[model samples]
Target: MYKNILAAVDGSSHGDAVVEAVASLAKLTGATVQVIHVRPSQVIGGAIASTVVPVEEREESQRVVDAAVARLRGDGVTADGEVDEGLREELAAILIERSEALGSDLIAVGPGHYSGISGLLHPSVSRGVAKISHVSVLLVRSES
Candidate 1:
């Protein structure tokens, strides 16, 4: 029944699988896919001194999105793409807002890198989004 899907991706090698899953789901439901990648913030803590993103980081982010789009197209699905700053950039809020702005029926997120203790101590954006989203969210675990 989903007509619009917010596919949240990290652009990791594992995350690519989530894109494929989203594409198949979109095909089945006749939904439009809104692909999003959050780059996290350029700074951490109160100061911007910790910024790690070089000027080329933006290009890298763009490349990630482009590659994802190409992958989807190869699968015969053309999805819209948007790249935002990640963790430091408040990816959680962006994901929530974009899903709403895009009128997405569901938000699909890839499983994160964290596992075991890390996953337990610091829930990822995906976990956070799943807890907070008003709409339904589908998680494609990394292994799957």
Candidate 2:
């Protein structure tokens, strides 16, 4: 029942699964997909310093988005991509905002990879998005 979908990727193996899941769903529902990659910004020097994202980092993020869009298009799914900059902790919010801006009905993201103390220290992006998203969320688990 989805008319538009937003797929978030991190260039990981799980990211591939996310693309695949989105592609299948988009094709099934005739939904257009918008793929996005958020490059984690880092503050230089100190907290007061400006947030900086290296050129290489920005290029890599664009590459991730481009690849996902290409794969979806190759599968005969209409798709486009964009790259955004944000902190790791704010990924969920960024994705949700973009999804709402684009009027997306579904958001597909990869499964969380952290566990134990690490999991507690760093919350999962997918879980965060699912928790607060007004629309449907699909957590694509990697087959590996």
Best by TM-score: 2
Model 2 scores a TM of 0.89
Relative to the true structure, candidate 1 reaches a TM of 0.81
Candidate 1 colliding pairs:
39-85, 39-86, 40-85, 40-86, 40-87, 40-89, 41-88, 41-89
The C-alpha stretches of model 2 lying farther than 4 A from their native spots are 43-56, 115-118
State the C-alpha lDDT per candidate: 0.76, 0.89
User: Candidate 2: deviation at residue 78, Å?
Assistant: 0.4
Most accurate candidate by lDDT: 2
lDDT by residue for model 2 (4-98), tens: 99999989889999999998888899999999988876445765666565434677888899999999999999999999888667889999999
Model 2 global lDDT (CA atoms, 0 to 1): 0.89
Clashes of 2: 0
Clashing pairs in 2: none
